[model samples]
Structure formats: structure tokens, C-alpha cells
Target chain A: MNRRTFLKDAIVVITGAALPAAALEWLDPRQVLAENPQIRWAFLVDTHKCAGCGFCVKACKAENDIPYEASVTRTWIERYVVTQSGELLADSPQGGRDGFTSGSIDLPGGTRVSEEEIIRGFFVPKLCNHCASPPCVQVCPVGATYATPQGVVLVDRQWCIGCGYCIMGCPYGARFFHPVHKSVDKCTLCTHRLTRGDASACVEACPFGARQVGNLHDPNDPVTRAVVSERIGVLRDSYGSRPRVYYLGLSKEVH
Target chain B: MKEYVWRPMYVVVLIAALSLAVRFFLLPHDFGVHEGGYKYGYYRLGNIAEWESRPALFRSADDCGDCHRQSESLSASPHAFISCQNCHGPAAGHPEDPPTLAIDTGRDLCLRCHADLSYPAGGRDAVPGIDPLGHHPFRSCVGCHDPHHPRQEVQP
Candidate 1:
């Protein structure tokens, strides 16, 4: 074959091989519904019922395989003590795993507020809000963090490059670096237990039924009904993250 | 066509072809945005199964009820809301290798929820706390109270 003819034939073959793969990108696979279309998992925290026992925190650590002594946890309880003078004193000793036994809250720089001066005190539990518009998912350079179809935010540890972008992107301070896995980790809503038809460890450990998980899409779900009918609020709604974790009787002092 | 134009076009097609071939070989079979489109976010599809494969270390109270009859008394008691694993530790492998779960009968276990901070606004007052020092010092709570049925005191 002539050199010119050979070159022309090769170009046609290469273009033909490449065109299909390139065009496939635009084909866009047909949108598949989640395994359970009705499932959109959400969390509820009843500040009034939370006794600051911290059973949930310990349970979460055990269930998730987080180090028993790790300074981080998937969930923690924050004690908000509002003084008579309206000074908000907050502290969570060991993330409330050991429970609050002290009468006074020690502040930074050697200051302490005696319990007698406190006009109001309450416990607020915190965890991944699993926002509808998750900043962590958005900021992940490697697409390591993502929201499941059921509305649970998950971190693919295998895919994570140990970058701290998602950790900083999370406004709720939910994400933490796993010392063992060497990756950014956050609450998975206990998907392992959820799929097994059991409540998350934290929810189950709560003797007061203060924490709960329910399907937001199911109108019959008790949590969904409470969220729709009760005076519920989310943490820092001003940020417009659309956090799915709802709080009942949320005090103003709690951000 | 001019030589310059044709030459650049040929190079562009060659690069595209080479890159596509590399991607075809290197890309994971299950890597892509799947259900719910990009709204659910792009991810490695196989990771879902990987997360699911992680076995749960905690089990439901009903799992314990399958074998232990003590779970029945617990269900009827005021402490029914509390899971067995909460005080006894996680029931990952119980009634087998361990044979029995270690029961945390310490005063601290009960005091976790029973300690008096007197924060009435938080609704913890309903739990009925005590001044651990004044109530009954140097003694375990179970000394007088039946943990299974806390309301009914154990006869000495």
C-alpha cells in the first residue's frame, strides 16, 4: 500500500475506535432509583430528653470500631449551661462519655462558673447533619465522600487519599481523621446495622429514646411526623446546608 | 487541507485515541455515578458494597432475647428502654466463645444516668438522681435494688 493511503487508513481506524468511548460519556446511563425508593434516612435529637448520660457516645465507638481512647467520636453530647447573667458556658468532658458529674464548668484561662449561678442547663447531642447540600462532599477533591441514595453521607476510606479537605469543609465538625485507617471518617448513620433492620447503636443505646433514626420519605414514620408537626429545628440553618438532623426543643444557646 | 492543519488534527486524534485506550483499561468497572445521578454524588459504585460488608459489632436486644430469659425481665422493667449491650458491652460474640457477657454492675454504670446535676430544664429530673455521697456511700446500687426490676427492692 502507498504511504499516503496507509496513513489515511490508520487515522480512520483510530478515530472509529475513540469515537464510541467518547460518545458514551454523553449517553448518560438511565437514572436508576435506589434499592428502596421510599427510604431517606434522617436523625432526630430531643434536647429535652437527652440526659447527657453519654451512653450513645460509648456505644457509637464500640459499634464503629473507633479507638476506645480516641479523642474523636462519631457522636458526642454537649452540655450548655446558661448562667443567670446570660453567659453561656458549654463543655463536654470526654464528649460526655463519662457523664457530667462536676457542679461547676471550668472555662478557659482559669475561670470557673459555680452551678448555683446557672439559670438553665441542657444537653445537646451532635453528629453529622448529613446535609442535603453537603459541603464535605462538595469539597472532596477525590470524590471520596458522597451521599448515599438513602440520604446517608458516607466516606469511602479506600478511595480517600487522607486529604483533610472534607474535615475542614464540614461545618458541624463531624468529620475526623481515623488514626488506624489513615483517612477522613464520619458518621455513616450505622448503615451496617440499618441494613440488618436494626437501629443505629447510638439510638438503641439511648435509654430515654432521645435519639432516633427514621425514614423522612415515609409519612407514617414517627420521626417524620414529629419533624413535620412538632416545633423542630436544625443546627445552624442560616448556613443553608439543609441538615437532616432535627432537634426538638432546641435552645437558642445551642448553635 | 494545509499540511500544518492536517498535522495538528492527526496529533489531536492520536492523543485522544491513546488516552481513551488507557482509561478503558485503568478505570474500575463499577466506578461512576449511579442511582439518583450526580445529586447523590459521583463515587466508586463498588464502595457501597464495601461499606455494607463491614459487620455490625453491636446487636439488638431481641438478639439476646433469643437465648437469654433475663431479657424478658428486662423488657417488663422500667429499664426496658436500655439495651443489654449498653451496660454489658457489645454482644458481637456472646453465648459462645465468651459463653456469657460481662455485666457492668458497678455503681458508676447506674450513676451515669442517675447522678444529680439538678438540671431540671433538660428533663433529666425524670430519671430520679441522688447525691451519690449522701444517698448510700461506699455501697453498690445493686445492694438494695434489683437492677432487673429497680422499683422493687431486693430483700436482704
Candidate 2:
């Protein structure tokens, strides 16, 4: 064959090979997830089982390489104390990294619950809810923060512009601007570990089976079974984020 | 009429072709999914499989049990379902670095499940409760009990 014809044929062959792979980029990720029923992941937090040990918080920090500062935390445990008069006070001291001690919390709501008047109290660990309808994902103008096919919310650090829009948009106060990367950061539900058949860092670190991560689509899965039978609650259900994270024994005092 | 129609049509066609050329020239190649480019480009968010390569810092209970024969005791106890990595921290590099894996059997660690609470009070009876100060005078639970099987006493 002539050199010109040979080159033309080679070009055609390369283009044919590359086109299909390039086309894959345009395929809707949500549609991909919808087709795969096994990808429906969820988080179940039983606050009643949580002992405020702060191990989950510490584990998250170590796993994610997050700063151990009070302001920057991927996950934190909130201690909710109810007074005899029914005054609710919530506080997370140093993101509960040092663990909780018996003490009074100064509430911004201007209600002080002394150690003596404490009627009821519980620890509620908070992290990225990985909402089906994440406001952070919606508000990201650059689409840096996007949910995976498995419904795990992730931040494409390379795509993030340090705009902090996702950080501001998150109502659960999950997203925070990473000091080192200067990009919006939050819990990924340990998508890395989950893909490897290991649980999330927080789930693995909970000595008490307080935190459980499971595929909701699997009928036999413990999380799915619990969700169906148990009266599980999501944080701020009225807001309609449809958060995948389910909570059992969530008190009314918790926000 | 033919002259007027042809001139505008020619200009419109020229503009459209020029715009297409510029768009093709200015647009990025590879969509920057892995290249750290600003735009995902044509909705190319890359493959989910990329996450699979990320290093897993945390190990499962089974992973820990694979090496430690002593972990079998936990399998029979109430904490059977609980992972070994929980109290021992992430044993990413275990036998290679023996001292690196420090097991935290502290009192606070035990209190995390045993602490007394009023809200969500149901079903907590399964896990015992104690006032850290009043009950044991700030003593560690492990000092008197076994962590793997709290119900079973440490046989001397």
C-alpha cells in the first residue's frame, strides 16, 4: 500500500479505538449507579450505642490526613445534654479528639446545664451524610464535589477552586476547607476502603458497633434489614436531603 | 434577491465554521479527569475504579485475625462482631513494625460503650454502664476484666 494510504488507515484505526473510551465520559454517572443495584450504600449510626469515646473522630482524622484542630474536622462527636427543665445544650469539645470528660458546656443558645442539673445526655457523631440530593454538590459551580455511582460524596481536589461554596452549602456542617490543600473537604464514607470490602475508617474504629456502613440494596445486608424493620431516622429529614446516613436513637436535642 | 440571500448566508456559514474551529482549538484534551485540569470537559468525571487504587489505611477485623492467633478469643465473646482494628488502631503495617500497633485498652475506651446515658435509653442494658468516678474510683475496666470477653474474667 502507498505510504499516504497506510498513514490514513492507521489514523482511522486509532480514532476508532479512542472514540468509544472518550464517549464513556459523557455517559450519565447517575444512570450508571441506577443500573447497578448493589451500589446503593448507606450509613447507620446508633447514637444509643455511641459512648462518646472520640475514637471514630480520631480514626477519621488519621485515615484522611486531616488536621487535628478544633475548627478542621472531618468527623466530630457532639454531646447533647438535657437539663431537668428540658433545656438542650450541644457541644463538641476539640472535636472530641481528647475524648469527653464530665463537664458543663456553655451553649450559644444561652442555656447553661450544670453537671448537677443534667437529666439526660447522649453522644451523636456527625459526618458527611452523603445525601442523595446533596446541596454541596448542587452548589458547587465547578462541579468539583460530586457523588459517586455508589452514592459516596467525594471532592475532586484537582477540580476544586477553593471557592468554599460546597463548604457553605453543606447544612450538616460536614464540609470544611482543608488547610493544606485549600480545597473543600469532607468525609468520603471511606470510598477507598469500601471498594476494598473494608468498612469506613469511623466504622472500623468504633469498638462498639455504633456505626455501621452497608449496601442498602442488598436485602440480606444488616444495614438494609435494620433500615426496613427498625425506626431509623435521618438528620434533618424535613430539609429533604434524603441523606443515606441513617441514625437510630437520635434524640430531639440533636440538630 | 439571489445576491442578497447568498451574501448573508455566506457570512453566517463563515461565522459558524470559524466558531467551531475556535471551540475545537480552545477546548482541552483528555477532559482533565486525571490530569488535574479545571474542567471535567464533556462531563467526563473519570472512572470509579480509580478509587480502588487508593491506599486503605484501616484494616478489617478479619485482616487482623489472619495473623494474630490470639484474636480467636474475641470471636467467641460478645465483642465478636467488633473489629480488632477498632481498639488497636489501624494496623496497616503490623508484624513489620510490631511496636507501631499500640492497643488502647484505656478506661475511656471502655466507657465509650459502657457510659450511662438517659436518652436513647432502650436496649442499652446489654452493655453495662458505670459512673467512671463514683463506681470504680477512676480505675480502668481492663485492670479487673478482659476486653475481648468482658463477661469472662481474666483466668489467672
Could you give the TM-score of chain B for each candidate, in order?
A: 0.79, 0.64
lDDT of 1 by residue, A5-99 (tens): 99999999998888866566644333323444568999999998988888899889988988978898889999998888888889987788777
Which parts of model 1 are misplaced by more than 4 Å?
Answer: A1-37, B4-13, B70-76, B133-139, B152-156
Sort candidate 1 into its docking category: acceptable
Give every collision pair in model 2.
Answer: A51-B112
Which portions of model 2 show Cα errors greater than 4 Å?
A: A1-37, A108-112, B1-44, B47-50, B71-82, B105-156
Tell me, by DockQ, which candidate is best. 1
Q: Best lDDT goes to which candidate?
A: 1
Listed in order, each prediction's TM-score against the native is 0.85, 0.74
Poorest lDDT segment (10 consecutive residues) of candidate 1 chain A: A27-36
**For every candidate, C-alpha RMSD to the true structure in Å:** 8.1, 9.8
Give the alpha carbon lDDT tens digit for every residue of B2-121 in model 1: 898899899999999999999788878676777646645788887877887779887775887787667566778888778888877687877665756667898878888888885564
